[model samples]
Target: MKLYQTYASPFPTRVRLLIYAKGLEVEIIEPPGFHASTEAKGDYLKINPIGRVPTLVLDDGRAIPESEVICEYLEDAFPEPSLRPADPWGRARMRLLSRMCDFYVVMAMVPLFNLSGRSRRHWTPEAIEAAAGKVAEALGWLEDYIGEDGFAVGGALSQADGAIVPQLVLAVEWIPSLFGTLDPLPRLPKLSAYWRAIQTDSICARLIGETRDAIAGVAAQAKAQAATSGG
Candidate 1:
């Protein structure tokens, strides 16, 4: 299988976490263009049509889009070393954490994109405050559900950890850099603890390092491009 992903994107990072945990033999590649506008055209759109990262193409030529759905497919296809809980309630808890990450947490981060990089010209106090507040609320919701044992759901790493890790990591850097706010994690104790504890897991540590490096790489490239263009 071929998985198209960009390391900086939280969505694809979640799927990559699962792939690493399961030791799946999937080829990872970047899409036609790493930018949104570039993704809307050409060969990549033909494959997934959504113009999104982390599209999984099976050997039979079937395409799967959306990170959460892709994670579910991988779990089903490769069940050993399962990332899901064994029981019903446990599975439900995992789903709940994933849902919060996707719906509430990711949604909160969306508005801040306008204020990102050279786009800070769009920043407004109201906009920044609103985004920060929304994310803080989302973090509180996560703290209520996240296990204190370092994993997001069960005693061990699960799909919930995959969902939580990348998004929270992005939130930690994005919010403070954009608005001079405190790192959001420290405000939520369970999540803050999980953030520190989960990194000790080898797969989580590697993926987190990749995500940070990719984000920094993108920022450096953007800065260099801006300098060249005299922006």
Candidate 2:
């Protein structure tokens, strides 16, 4: 099996977290025709018509899109080091957290993403404030649902951790840089504690480092592009 993904994206990063944590043998490759300059097209669209990152292609040639579905497929396909909780309610909790990351957390971050970095000048002060407010509301939801056990769903590392941690890293860096807002995670006690504790896990730490590095790389590229074009 192979996963077509980009390191810069949280959606793909979540799938990667599961791959790394489980020691899966799937090959990781960038989607064809996908880059800062271009969207996924041509060959990539043939494999997964959605033209999105983190598309898993099975050896039998079936394609899976969307991070949540991909993660569930991986967990089911490679069940040795199971990421799902053993109990029914625990599994439900795991799915709920993952869904929150999808529906609430990532959705809130969308506006900030639109207004981030060089795009800030294109947006008004009022627009930026509203975007930041939406982000804060989403963070509040996370604070309410998050467990005290350091993991998202259960006491151990599960699919929930894979789902949420990458987005948290993005929020930690972007909330302050883009919105001039304080680090909201630190203000939310449970989330702050969860963030601090999760980083101690080597896989989590590695993925976090990959995400930060990817963010930096993108920033540098943007700077270079802006300089070249005299923006």
Candidate 3:
């Protein structure tokens, strides 16, 4: 099996974490310069027409797109390291948590991704606040789903935890950079404790460390570009 991914991308990172959990030996590939959507279609286009990241190509040559779908496939295909809850209702709640993280938290956070690296002169103050506001609002909803001091679903790291942690990482880091003093974690106790608890897990810690390094590389690249442009 082969998986297409970009190191710093949060969505693809989710799949990477899942792969790590199952100890699956899937080949991970980065996108070739351009996607199928562009005028010039790259090799990745042949398998995934949509040309999105995190497309999983199975052994028989069938390609699976979307982070969530790929993870579901992994769950069904590799059940040994179970990421979903045992009961049906528990599964639904996990899905609900993931859904909220994707639609509510992630969608809002997307706009703010590059805000920290760019000069304030390049972006509107209102735009930054608007996106942050969406995050805070959606995070309030997420608070209802988590416990006071455990994993996203419980002691085990389920799909819900995989889906939500990346978004929280973004908010925890970016909010202070974009807004002078605004912080998300302190306001959300359960969510904050969840972040602290998960850090001790080897899988979470390892992947999160890799992500931080990737994010740092991106910031350095942005700084170099800005310096060159200013010169």
lDDT for each residue of candidate 3 in 1-231, tens digit (9 for 90 to 100)? 999886676778778878999999999887764311123546878878887777998999899999999999998899878998898887888899988987888787767765655675757778877878888888989988885547777568887877776676677774656465388778888888888988887887776787677666666766676677782
Query: All candidates' lDDT scores?
Result: 0.84, 0.81, 0.77
Which stretches of model 3 miss by more than 4 angstroms? 33-41, 114-119, 178-181
Model 1, 36-153: lDDT tens per residue? 2223346988887878788999999999999989999999999988999999999999999999998999898887754665455567778888888898999899999999887987
User: Model 3: which residue pairs collide?
Assistant: none
Q: What TM-score does candidate 3 get on C-alpha atoms?
A: 0.88
In candidate 1, which residue pairs clash?
Answer: none
Candidate 2 residue lDDT tens string, 147-212:
898788779888888778888887878567756776777679998999999999888889889888
Model 1: ten consecutive residues of lowest lDDT: 32-41
Q: TM-score per candidate, in order?
A: 0.93, 0.92, 0.88
What does candidate 2 score on TM? 0.92
Each candidate's root-mean-square deviation in Å? 1.9, 1.8, 3.0
